[model samples]
Target: MVDELEKAKPIIIKRVKRKGHDFHGGSWKVAFADFATAMMAFFLLLWLMGNTSEDEKQAISGYFHDPSGFQEKAGSSPAVIGEGGANVAVIEIETIQPETDDIESEISKNEASNKPLSEEELAKLAEQKEIEKLKQLKKELEFLVENSIDFSQFREQVMIDITPSGLRIQIVDKDKRPMFDSGSAEPKYYSKTILRGLANVLKQVPNKLSVTGHTDATPYVERENYGNWELSADRANAARRELLFGGIKEKKIARVEGFSSSILFDQQNPHNPVNRRIAIIVLKRSVAENIEKQVLGVE
Candidate 1:
């Protein structure tokens, strides 16, 4: 009777069925892939922001804000969403115009200068700018002399130095190679080339030029009437002609003078080859003005 009761009461079996994520069928995998992609994009955004310049960031922001307002030259840098490795500087981005009239006064207030410059202030500023310009020109000339293949053979003969007047470029005669034929105004081929090259460079600047020709103490015996003075003047004119041929304008030439053994480069040895030189002076505006005034007997 006891066995019969136990069998009737507890004859049930407990069977558990196992389940798998296969029921979802790659849904979780899709979510995981999306998460990874988003992480990668976030890292990339951080990298781009770090590499971009402040101006570029503003430009990009401006673009996103108002693409219609964007203005830039064609064929500009497009590879990196910024400047590519081009010879030109990165294009300056123009900001979008203000939409609201309320900000107009504020903009004007910001744009308005505190005070206009006085004449004296203007002159001082101009003088400062001229000094900077001369310094930069000196640097460029020095760089050309040091690294240019065109001036390789004539490096020793080309001397550049800043003077109280302005920047002075002297092309002196070497022991073996003189700029001109013996006691002649005609320039050597290489000398002409040097002057032409210099003219090409100098034409870029707006400064007036002064060219002077010099000769050694040795007197010219080529002609009875013509001496070193006339020879020197002829040489100076010849140099001026070459400069003009090389694209320098006629108006840019301020003075063309000749000092025959008067302003010796080698004062101790006036007869030295170094004393014979052609000097190109980019005169300071003040000095040039003073010279003009003195010549004209103005002040």
Candidate 2:
């Protein structure tokens, strides 16, 4: 019985088996996925191109060709050959070319003919017009002041002139009637009446205003920290407030400055009472813009 059991067990045999694709593995699957993704992207591009307008297509092409907008225009940025044949950057300023016969050139020509003036040209023209306007305003102001019953007494004290800055209206201190109390910022009754009349006329125009206060060469005793600077500044601020009360918009007052006996109206006599005055200036737009730029810390 043992021999029969051994012979039956010994009859069993072991064999090795192998699959066909063991070496290739999953590499082909990755390659097929990459191919499918590329085909999808290509089809999307085709679809977009088919739907896009000519201008849009041109714009897209331009973006791809020159991604930077500062592309080299003719005579704008010329290249210079260096000693070692290396390229160096050089700028060349040239006048804009004249009209041409191409359709685009014709359109550009028409645009150039009908186009608005350049910034510089427009500024010059505007300045000229502003000068004329200020001249007219000066005439009107003179007429108004001359005819007004309230300003009859103060006629000689009012001085209006056209300056490079704009119209300057100076109210001087008179021997009989002072604009302010001695060594004070408070305006007298007559001063208020004059300021109010000027404000009424000034409010009619869109120009900005600059109010400046001047003091005579008379010395002030330093009581605490108060001196000429304080007095002058306070007087300027006081004038600004009065102008606001006289219907001039607060925003219209661009500057309030104090020049304490520095810029004298009567240079020959620094101590002249006329040096103690208030100057109201209507600033030109360009000058005002420059002042604003300076205030904003721009170059």
Candidate 3:
């Protein structure tokens, strides 16, 4: 009975099925590959642009601007020159040219006309050029004075201005900062430094130069036969020598003069310190020409 009961006992078996994670799509991989390919093409395009010649670049630009214009004007012809077949033979090709060349040619034609300019017109042209050069020189000097620490300290004393005569550069004296020794023509060290620096700049312009010296109304009787007039003249000459030392040609100097308290900068105060100064003028072309003609005894 026991054996029959054991054999009749029920037996059970269970099985669990576990599902895997969801499958992610491959869209991002395709997008990333496309981005990488685009970057590579972009770099290749940049390299090509960097290596292309100006003419090739222009040709490419023209083709893009008007693709139809790049087509060759042609007619149907035989491929072997005897039998007629559907064939296009390019006879001519038109190219795009820059518009600036046309404008330049027009200007050149106008300027290179047969008729010569009158003397007055020539003078006006020369004057215009002289004015331009002087203005540029003035600008350079002003920039130097403003930006350079060496020149900034004496900015007030180093006065520069444009006048009808031409560019006028004045190195004037302060109350205690005289450019020269009192009652003497000897230039102070800093004064020589200033003159040499100015000379290097003045050498760039083709115009003739005029250097002048002036003194205040205070009378000087320190040396025999040496008054303000002689002192001023000597000072002017000394400045000229320094200019020559700084690489300016001697022929560039048109005149050296001295005015003893005659043209006081501050008219109200005759003895003002500012009256003592060195004035260097870059003469205009017309004036220089007139000077040359006069020296040559031409009417």
Instruction: Report the number of the highest-lDDT candidate.
Output: 1
Task: Please give the CA lDDT of all the candidate structures.
Answer: 0.75, 0.74, 0.72
Q: Give lDDT for model 3.
A: 0.72
RMSD of 3: 20.4
lDDT of 2 by residue, 1-299 (tens): 99888888856577878677854789888888999999999999999999974434544554455544434322243222222212121212121111123334544665789975566754565566667777777876786566455577899999999998888999999886889988789999889988977886687677789999999888767577777777888888888888888789998888999889889888999888898899999888777777789899987
Query: 203-269 in candidate 3: lDDT tens per residue?
Result: 7666788899999999998788888999889888989999998778999998898998889999999
Give Cα distance to truth, residue 264, candidate 2, Å: 0.6
Q: What range of 10 consecutive residues in model 1 has the weakest lDDT sum?
A: 80-89
- How good is model 1 by TM-score? 0.60
Q: How do the residues 192-249 of candidate 1 rate in per-residue lDDT, one tens digit apiece?
A: 9889878767877767789999999999987999988888888988999999998899
Off by over 4 Å in 3: 1-116
Better of 1 and 3 by lDDT: 1
Order of all candidates by lDDT, from best down to worst?
1, 2, 3
Clashing pairs for model 2 are: none
